[model samples]
Target: MKWVKIKKAEINEWNEKLKATHASFFQYPYYASGYTFFLFSKPLYIKLVNDQQQELGYSCILNVGAFPFKAGLIIRGPVFFKTNVDHRSSLIALKKFAVKERYTFLRVNANEPAIEELLNTDSEFEHKDYFPSYKGSQGIDLNIYYKPFDELLKSFRTDCRNKIRFANEKNYLFEKVKTSTDLEKVYDLFVGLGSKKKFSYRPLKSYTKIFKEGIKHELCSVYTASLDGRIICAAFIVKDSQSFTYFSGALELQNIPAKYSPANNLHYLIMQDCFYKEDRKIYNLSYSPRESGVYMFKTSFRPEEICKPGFYTYVINRKIAERIFSLQGKSISAIRTKLRSIIKLFNK
Candidate 1:
């Protein structure tokens, strides 16, 4: 198999190819653009083909870090056109490409179980421990869209159903955000939530660019829930041809009553909106640890657990890669500590 590098001029064709396959949002060009803007990672689009020059799959990799210690990341991809395609050859080609480009290592978090099995069986690839990728996510089958609204509602757990109804009864206005000004309001809610939850999030400018580009390409939707003209909850959903992935969400828990269910209601509306869209068959709730409260909340929706092989790393130069990984981890930890301190100060 051979890998063909795709240039920026061919992105339209790349997008067309993606539409014909079951590629995820992470493989989309706009999604990569966001990382490029904020993280300064260079996007590398490559198409895999057999010796016969027939297309088998495509990968959107992000090349990160500096010279002599660069890493190539395949985030949730190398989306194949068919289920039976030879993933091993593709993996070999990726490794060769990374080596040829002088990368220290290559990390892949493919969405395919088969590929994961291949990586496990292969001696060259090792299970990544530090900064491991998500192994699974909760997803609702959008075929439920054909059922009656009441029947769909009945599918959820009782408490979830009650929360949805209660949220509706509270008359919180749920709407798709259209203007930039409203998006900023949603960002504020997201930042506020991150502060309260003590979690890290992308900066406002990064989110603004991402959302704007995504909206312009019809690949993203931002939803907001408000009571008395005050926003309380917001969510960002990214769409591919086959699924709507819940990317980010924030809730103003302090502003709303504990009994209020704005978050649940917002998700319900999102599901409905995704169902109405053609060819979108799945509503992905994104990743959460099985033991976490967030996992329980998502489970209340009765979504099936979709599992995948987690991250694997192929190191071209183990010594250099290990040192780079150490430094990267420390940098990330320091950043998180700084963010937590800032959030604490802001809360005070």
Candidate 2:
């Protein structure tokens, strides 16, 4: 098979036909603008074809990284139009391209079934363990087998259902975010949430583009839960034609009343919007660690657990890549360990 790097128009043309939820927003041409503040991003499309020039599959690559740390991120890509493409061959071709381009590593979060199968089989690629991981996401099918809204509530755990009722009793109202002022409220809450949860937060400008560019283009939407004119929680939803991903959500845990569960209520409202308004087939809760608090909360809504081979890294230069990646892992682990000790000390 031959690999040909196609243009943005071609990528859009192909994506127009595919409209798969398994893909990443990062791979979308429009989504690139939101990410430019973090890394230099270029939308790339590599088409796989046979000797007869028959189209096999196409990969959407976001070529990104800082100076002296170049990497290619492939998110749910090498989307095949036909069923006959060789996953290994296409991957090897991608590796060759990365090496030729002098990238340090090529990281892939394979979403396609064939590619996931290949990654699971213990192929040549080396796995890179990164935080805020690129693992498979949990998603709820909005169509086909999904139960009706009332049935869905019944399926939730008793405590979860009760929490929703409590939120209702609190009389929280959900509204679509429309202005820059609303965006700042969400960002401030998100920052507060990040500090409380002890996780890294994206800069405000990163979110600004998502609001201005993504929402303006109708690729995303923001909804806020409020009580007495105070925003208690907010959720950002991103969509392709087939799915609505709950990309991010922020909660003001301190401000909400004892009986109210802002997260649950906000998500319930968001899911309703996904089902009724968006008419999307999948309501993606996005990725979270299994059995974690976030995971339990998401699963309480009864979304299906989507399992697949997550992120894998193919190091172009073994010696340099190993040292760099290993150091990164160790550094993060050290910081986490120190933070935990500090927290324990404070408790004492």
Candidate 3:
């Protein structure tokens, strides 16, 4: 079998064929990469075919130019099938691509079955590790597979439900905002919540853009929390297939009474109706809350287990790409070690 580089003539054909092969976020049509981005980038598609030109395996790659160091990130990616194609060789090719472009480093998040499988095999990395990750497949699925409102809360810890009830007892009201003007109150409360939680501050522009897009594509929605007429909390969710992703949420802390927690109350209202009932999508609790306080709070809303793979596939660079990739490996290893020390110091 021989593998040939894919050109523009086969763009649509490649995507359509890959769709039938795997359930990968990197392959999904809506993501930044899947969309018209390929137009500007002109992705690289490799197909392992028989003499009859019958396709046996395929993958997609992008000769991407990254910022900061202005490195060329020729990613070997979007591998759908691997029966005949060699994983190590492909990775080596990826590295070669990096070196040819004179890139300082090569970054790849190959969507494979498991990272463990790549270890102990050929092409083992010396300076490779993980960074704080962004949830992908699971995030979208939460928006795709929705549960009915009533039954959705069955898994929530009793305390979480009680908190919602408590929020109601405190006379909090939920409203669906249809216009940007209506978002002001929700935005204020959300910002307040963010400050209280000591979380990162994202500009209003970001949330507004997401909310508008969600409405446009029917991909997700936003909800505002109120006590009578005064807004107290706000959240936005993105719909992905059958999953209702909990994009982000914020709640006022000090202004509200001690009887109820804003996050719990805000989440339940969305789960029971906005997402679960209205959207008919599954509720994603989002990143398994790691902060002790946040984890305690999220546990109240029991969730199902979802183990999703990270990265789509690995490609190695030849000659020059290999050296650049090696530098990247060393950098990642150093950063991970430093991060671990920081976490340790925080714990101490």
RMSD to the true structure for each prediction, in A, is 6.3, 7.5, 9.1
Q: Which predicted model would earn the best lDDT?
A: 1
Which order, best to worst by lDDT?
Answer: 1, 2, 3
Output the lDDT of residue 252, model 3.
61
Error of 1 at 268 (Å): 1.0
| Tens digit of per-residue lDDT, candidate 2, span 213-282 | 6664467788888888877888887776666778788777575565577777777767777777767666
For model 2, the superposed segments whose C-alpha errors exceed 4 Å read 6-26, 39-45, 49-56, 64-68, 120-123, 127-145, 253-255, 287-292, 330-348
User: Sorted on TM-score, highest at the top, how do the candidates line up?
Assistant: 1, 2, 3
Candidate 3 C-alpha lDDT tens digits along 4-113: 66675654444345444543324322222332222122234566565787766555444332321222222223353646655655555555544554444444544454
Question: Which of the two candidates, 1 or 3, achieves a greater lDDT against the reference?
Answer: 1
Candidates 1 and 2 compared by TM-score, better number: 1
lDDT score at residue 336, model 1, on the 0-100 scale: 39
Quote each prediction's TM-score: 0.85, 0.78, 0.59
Quality of model 3 by C-alpha lDDT: 0.51
lDDT of 1 by residue, 1-348 (tens): 878887779864665568787787778877776665444356788888888888888888877654554677887787888677878878888889888888778887777677778888889988883233222222222222333456767888898888887787787888999988888898888777778888877666666766776776677888988888888888888878877878788777665665676887788778877776445667878767779777777878888765555788888888877765665435554533543454466567
Query: Which lDDT values do the candidates have, in the order given?
Result: 0.73, 0.66, 0.51
